[model samples]
Target: MDAGAAIWEYLGADAPVADLPAMGYGEVASGYATTHSAESVGIIGGGYVGIETAEAFAEHGLDVHLFEMVPHTLQPFGAEAAATVEDHLRKQGIDLHLDTAVEGIDGAGSVERIGTGDHTVPVDLALVGVGVAPNTELAEAAGIELGTTGAIANDRYGQTNDDQVYTARDCAEATHTVTGEPDHVPLALTANRAGRAIGATLAGDPTPIGEIAGTAAVKAFDLEVARTGVIDEESAAEAGFDPVSVTITAQSRAHYYPGGEEIQITLVADRESERVLGASMVGREGVAKRIDTVAAALHAEMTVHQLSYLDLAYAPSFSPVWDPVLTATKVLHGKVAG
Candidate 1:
């Protein structure tokens, strides 16, 4: 991996907000928290990083005020599904401000308060989690091409334009299986796989990196959120597929089982091809593994019909006669036919 990237400051980009000068210069501060002792903290952008960091601070007895311009926290999960996790965040004592714009983060040398146009929240520190762009300065100077996502351009084996130079991890893009195109995922899992493939290539064994599964998971207090593949109708359409989506609520275990939890699954499939496009899940337990099953199906390019008949292990205490995953695809398959 190269130098990775810095947090992008996108608030009030064109017009300067009072004391803040430019996008990256101010309106926010740059710092990550392994731990902090401040009484109150203000977090900008309620995406993955912002929500997790807010949860961590709330658990440590620090007052947290999370601000997001969007109506929901997790953009990938959609507003409806993301609301479930947002509810839990509020119950955990995190002050959430939805559909709120922060004008600037101002202080002498450190952040003292965040001005959001209508109100100002006092904060000892501010963490910005807007997004990142790859550090390709040196690579660009060396005549290396950059992808559409502004990340370093490289082949599947981490070989750059110059055969003598190689790069991997967050700096480069990977071929997404769904789109059959290069995308900047920058997740640790993809980074690790790319690193391994590059090592094999250097050892005289050419190991072209496999396609990305487009999988990710995160825990929000009591809820564990997992999703993979396309999941959104717009994305599926942009990738050249007629998308069909369905949502189902199922039990995590047999009805007769003593301990079980409610699992909400939203599955998307191709309308014409009946192929499983993507899926998302929100629940307390059995989340990480269930999403992995779908991730494997995505890797294998399984259709909705095939996924419906998957021979997953089942036990009264562990899973119901028909697992939640099967229930979701079986429903989606019917819709595909209809």
Candidate 2:
């Protein structure tokens, strides 16, 4: 939406890796596929990649065994939040196995059995999304020092410790706005922002890089999931703020609108300031757009008062006079004010 040519430069960040291997990027790049003959496929990690791969394998007539070590499906994001997503996942015929961890992956050459601490499960494929380490091998091989998270460390201007080199994307580190700590948040928006700021600096304009708000969105079947700012309770606590959160269900548009859809919005605000710190939304019909609006507000350091008063378009055919996002903001404002 911020189309000042500064932003458009990041519209095309090249996709470097094709498909990920069970092990490393090199194995993936060398054309490898490890599969077995089994009715059920085991997927390790219930994060976005694991769940998506599970759904795809299931559609091809394979029963899916989704292993997530967390008591809830997506840990750190809360059980209630995970349950809403798991419901949709189960409908896709995936066997959601929480509290399960992958001990080892075994096969002669191709994958056959996935080992748990208790026993081994026979599977056609073992998909792992335990998370990713930075693809810093290129930078590392060239003697660019790596950080604790295995990312290429860059200064505020996207310059690596090496002056001539500029890096963005999953390979680079990010400065968290809330905690004032550096992290590796390999998200598209972060990459885009970094690219823009770096491009500006390179093109005769001196723009200082700002803190990243950690916003992201995803689509899982009918669910349009988006989370912006910070949702990690640990991070919130560490950031020296008492975080209060609320969840509400509302229609995407006015109830009177013929095709109105339902969505769930969750908001986190500072207990004392009532300033929105984070937001998550799950539903249909432009859910990502609505979340983006809140994300912008969070970046602008807007309070719930400003969120409630933000000018968002509305029509009986589009949204109620009060959009669901604004409505949720008003709710948080009341809770904080009271």
Q: TM-scores, in order shown? A: 0.86, 0.82
TM-score of 1: 0.86
Tens-place lDDT digits, model 1, residues 179-289 = 777888778888888889889999999998777867888888778888888877787898999999998989899999988998989998888888888888899888867
Deviation in angstroms for 263 in model 1? 1.1
Pairs in clash, predicted candidate 1:
none
Candidate 2's residue-wise lDDT over 1-338, tens digit each?
11212111221213233232233433332334322244667888987777666755666577888888877665434455577888888887777778877888888876778868686787756667888778887898888877766788888888888898888868888777655677787878678878998999999796656677777666666777777776756667777877888888889878877988888888888888777788778887758778878878877888888888989998887788889998898888888887
Error of 2 at 244 (Å): 0.5
lDDT of each: 0.80, 0.73
